[model samples]
Each structure stands twice: as structure tokens, then as C-alpha cells.
Target: MRKLVYLVATTIDGFVSDAADSDPTGTVFDPVGAHAAPLMAEYPEMIPTHIRPMLGLTDTPPKHFDTVLEGRGSYEIGLAGGVTNAYRHLRHLVFSTTMTGVDDPAIELVNTDPAARIRELKAEDGLDIWLCGGGTLAGVLRDEIDELHLKVYPVVLGKGVPLFGIPTQDSRPGLDHFTLRSATPYDSGVSLMIYDRTR
Candidate 1:
């Protein structure tokens, strides 16, 4: 069975994007820093297909994930840039109920329950699934996530999207479902932290 890995970049304050929810790359966060080399070398699959040639990773095989998942917002970010399918090299699934007319055969739109679909995907034989997210989708599939590979930057976005998209003041108490597996600090003040689900 393959694992569902929520691989994302976040700020020290635990925000994935700023208040406007814009693309963090090269704007709020620098992707070409010291951490770039190691990250690209290890998880080349995370790089969008269109960006591989410039980064000299055209032939580099994916090390961690074979499939990629995203929410409507995350998918639209690329669509807005005229990129219908960003991760063309991977099996891409976009969860959206209101989105329609996506003619890209390479991308599949999932309108059903996220957790149920993830459970079905986990039972298939393949590399781990990469949950390239927006917070709302993360909240829906929180319990189904098997691992979290976070690129923690040093910046602090005073307010923005939460890591899980769950309200901080929600009545439900937090659960310790994951344990820190490794933490790799880079000279650029960025850290690659990996956590594995223990429950």
C-alpha cells in the first residue's frame, strides 16, 4: 500500500500562503536558496514538469511520489498561469466540486469524499501520493495522511492560511498522530522536517 504524504512549504508561523494566498515561490519565499540543491536532488518529482528543463532535471526520476493531489485553489493557481496540468509527469488529481470544463485529460477532477478516495488510493500499488495542498483539502484528509514532509521557511506571515485549515479555536482538541522523524536544517534558514504518522 502506498502512503499519502502531505508535502508542502510553510512559514515559521505555520502559514502556507499570505493573506491573499498568492504563490509563495520567489515572492514570499525564495526557492533558489541553499536548500534548492538538496531538495531538487532528492525530490525532483516535486518540481513542475514545465520547470524541469530550466532546472536541468528533465531526466531526473521521481524519488518520493508518483501521484500528486491538490485542492481547487492550488490547481487554479497554475491554471491561472495558463498551466492546465503543472505536474504532468505525475498522476494528478484535483478535488473540486464547483470547477468544470477542465478539458485536460491528464488531470482528473475528484468531486467525491477526499478521505474515502485517499483510502482507495492507498490500497493501490505505487509510490507515495503527494498532497500538494491548500489548507481546506488538508483539513478534510488530515486523518488519512500518513506522512508530512514540510519545508519550513524562516519567514513569518502574521496571518494567512493555517497548516490544517482547521480553526485554531475549534472545540476539538489537537491529537498527537505524528512523530518527528527527521529535521534537516539548511544554511538559508530553511528546514526540511519529516514526520511519520504513529497512530
Candidate 2:
């Protein structure tokens, strides 16, 4: 069975993106500084197909994921930039109810239960599934996440989209636990933390 890895970049205050829902790595800060080389070298698959050539990773095989998952908001960011499918190199899946007529055969849309569908995907033979998120979907599939690979930036957004967009006060499912596996800090004040879900 494959694992579901939530690989995302977040601020020290635990916000994945700002309130405007713009790409944090683009508008808020650039990720091409000192941390770029090691990050891109370690996770080449995370680079978009169009960017691979520029980064000289055009022929590099994906080191981690063979499939990429994202919420409607995350998908729409690329769509808004005239890109219907951003991660065209991988099996792209978008979870959205209102989005219709995607037309891109390479991109799959899941309007139903996220966790259930994820369970099915985990059972199939493949590399790990990358949950390249936008908070809400992370909350929905929180229970199914097997690993968390967080790139913690030094900045602090006073308020924005949180790491987990779930409501905390409600009598929802209990919090899942994870064990920190590794933490690598870069000169750019960015740290990469890897945590494995505690079963």
C-alpha cells in the first residue's frame, strides 16, 4: 500500500498561505534563494512540469510522489494562471464540488468523500501520494495522512489560511498523532520537518 504525504510549506506561525489565497511562495516570498537547491534536489517531483527544464531537472525522476492531490483553491491558483493542469507530469487530482467541465483528461476531479477515495488510492500499487494542499482538504483527510513533510519558513503571517483548516471547538474526530522523524534547517531560515504518523 502507498502512503499519503502532506508536503507543504508553512510559516512559523503555521499558516500555509495568506488570507488572499495567493501562492505564498510567489507573492509572499521567493523560494529560489539558498534553500532552493537542496529542496529541489531532494524533491524534484514537487517542481511543476514547465519549471523542470529551467531548473535543469527535466529528466530527473520523481523521488517521492507519483500522484499529486490538491483542493479546489490550490488547483484554481494554477487554473487562474491559464494552466488547467500544473502538475501534468503526475497523476493530478482535485477535490471540488462546484468545479465542473474540467476538460483536462489528465486532471481528475473528486467531488465525493475525500477520505474514502484516498483509502482506495492508497490500496493501489504506486509511489506515495502527495497531498499538495490548501488547508480545507487537509482537514477533511487528516485521518488518512501517513506522513507530513513540512517546510517551515521563518516569516510569520499574523493571520491567514492555517496549516489545518478544521474547526477546533466542535466535537470532531480526535487529533491524530505524529512522531518527528527529522528536521533540517537551511541558511535561509527555512527548516524542513518530516513526521511519520503514529499508528
Candidate 3:
């Protein structure tokens, strides 16, 4: 089966946005763009000195997998203004119930059973699926997620959007199997931690 990998960044307080939902709470972290470096340089006090080298401060456009999957809201965040193949380098799949279809050739929108469809993708020959954004889709398919690659920024957003909307009741999300995978400290006191789920 194909695997679903969630790669996202969140605040230390566990919120993705602010009360207004206008943008991320801190200036030190940028989840969607090439925002990490500049933010770090501006606020050296926020980031730990020891962690900088480990985090690959110079790295931008990092790739954890070859496939990208996202919910409509998540997709819109990067595409609302216009067309730009955010994940053009790889296969992109968008999950949306409101969208009748997608005109963007770069993305394939699914109005069908997303979880089941993901299962089919997992069965394919190779590559893991990158679950890109929004809590709703993640909540809906909580069972399908196999790993979470979170870039934990140090700031705290008392409230805003959460990373996962679903509450796992029947079983744990399986954090024990996670390999520290990778990590690096940012200049903003934030550390990017990538966790790989083991099945």
C-alpha cells in the first residue's frame, strides 16, 4: 500500500494560525514560502546557536517525498492568487468536496473517497504521499496517516488553526515509532523536527 506522509510546520503553542487567521503568528517562521532564512537573520535572539548547523539553515525547497497531497483549503493558501505549480516537481493531488473539478493541469482534484483513493495510491509501485495542509482533511483521514514531518517553530500562538483537527480515540497516532528523522535549530529558537512513522 502507499503511505501518507504529513509534512507541515506549527507553532510551539500548537496553533497554525492566529485568532484572525490572517497569517502565521510569528515573523520567524514561514510554512508556505521561502521565508525561513530571512526570518532567522532578523531575529537571532529567538533561535538557538547550537541548532542552526543541524537544521540546514541554507536549505530551501526541501523535499521529503515525491508526491504531494492537499485539501482544498491547503491548496488555496498557495494558489488563491493565481496559478503557480507549487509542487510542480512532483505529482499533486488535491482533496475537495466543494470543487466540482480542477482546471489546473498541475493538480488532480478528487471529489471522491480520498482515504480509499489514497489506499490505491499506496499500492502503486513506489514513492510515499505527502499530505499537504489543513486540519479538516487530516481529521477526515486520520487513520490513513502513517507519519508526520513537523517543523516545530518556537513561538506560541494561543489560538488559531490547529495542525490536526481530528482527535484519535480508538488508537494512538503511533508516535513511538517515529524516528527523529531529521532536525535543525532555526535562528528564531524554533527547531524543525521531522518524524517518520513506522508501520
Candidate 4:
């Protein structure tokens, strides 16, 4: 089975966005511009095809996942600007309770148990599935996650949406066991940490 990887960026305070409750779509983490150099260089596949050349990474191929998953709020960040498909290179799947359909043909809208669908995706033959964003969805599918690919930045968001929407560690005590597989630190104080679920 393919791995369900929660590949996301987070601040030192463990918040994914700045004031997620108030402005979830706002770009809270400011260091992404400077941090993008090492990140895009190391993980070229993560670069979207639309702005690849603009970032001087046109030939970069997706190195990790062949499919990407996102929550409604995560996908809506681009939807407000008429961009339904942000990552056009990979297979995009968005989870939403209210969104029945979307304008983008490349993106699929699903309103059901995300964990069940994730399990089914793992059974298929392809690269691992990338849990793109949203702490709420991450909290819901916490158990189903096999690995975490975190881009840890130096900034701190005192109050915002957490890495996981809810407290996974507090809710399931002694269940959230993970070991750091590797940690690559960059000059910009951004670290690429890969942790595997070891339970």
C-alpha cells in the first residue's frame, strides 16, 4: 500500500497558518519566500508546473507523490481567485461536506469519510498520496497517516490553526508515536524533517 503522507509546512509555534480561525486563507508564514530556495531545490516535484519556470524550476519532476489531497478550506485558498486546480501536475482530490461539484475537471470533489477514501487510494498502484493542507482534515485522518513530511520554518505563529486542527496527542494519548527518520536543516533556518509512524 502507498503511504498517506502529511506533507505540510509549519511555524516554530506548531501553527500551520497565522490566525487560522480569523484569517485561514491569509499567508501567515512569511519566510516561505526565502525558504523556497532550499525547499524547491531539494523537492523540485513539489513545485507547481504553472510557476515552475518563474521560479527557475521548469524541469522539476514530482519526486514524492503522484496524488494530492486537500480539505475544502485548503482548496478554497485558490478557489477565491478562480483557480480550482493549483497543482495541475498531480491528481487532486478535495474533501468537503458542502461542495458538491467544482469547475476544474482535474480536481475531484468528495463529500464522504476521508479516511475510508484514503485507505482505498493506498490500495491503488501509484506513488504515495500527499495530504496537501488543512489542520482539520489532518486531525480527522491522523491515524491513517503513515508518514509526516514537515517543512519547519523558524518563524512562530503564536495563535493560529495548529499543525493538526485538533489535539491528536491529547485526544489519543500514547498513540501518536513517531520517530524522526531524517532532518535536513537549511541556511534559512528551515528544516526538512521526515518522520515515520512507529507504533
TM-score of each: 0.95, 0.95, 0.70, 0.88
lDDT of 4: 0.80
Show where candidate 1 strays beyond 4 Å.
166-173
- In the order shown, what is each candidate's alpha-carbon RMSD? 1.6, 1.4, 7.9, 2.7
Which whole-number lDDT from 0 to 100 does residue 73 have in model 2?
88
Candidate 1 shows a clash count of 0
lDDT of each: 0.88, 0.88, 0.64, 0.80
Writing each residue's lDDT as its tens digit, candidate 4 over 14-84 gives 87776644333235544455566767766666666676788877766777888998898888777776676
Candidate 1, residues 1-199, lDDT tens digits: the string is 8999999999999988877777778877798889999988889999999999999888888898999999988888897899989998999999988887475898888998888899999999999999989887887788888999999999988898777875756524668488999999999999999999998
Residue 185 lDDT in model 1?
Answer: 97
Off by over 4 Å in 2: 166-173
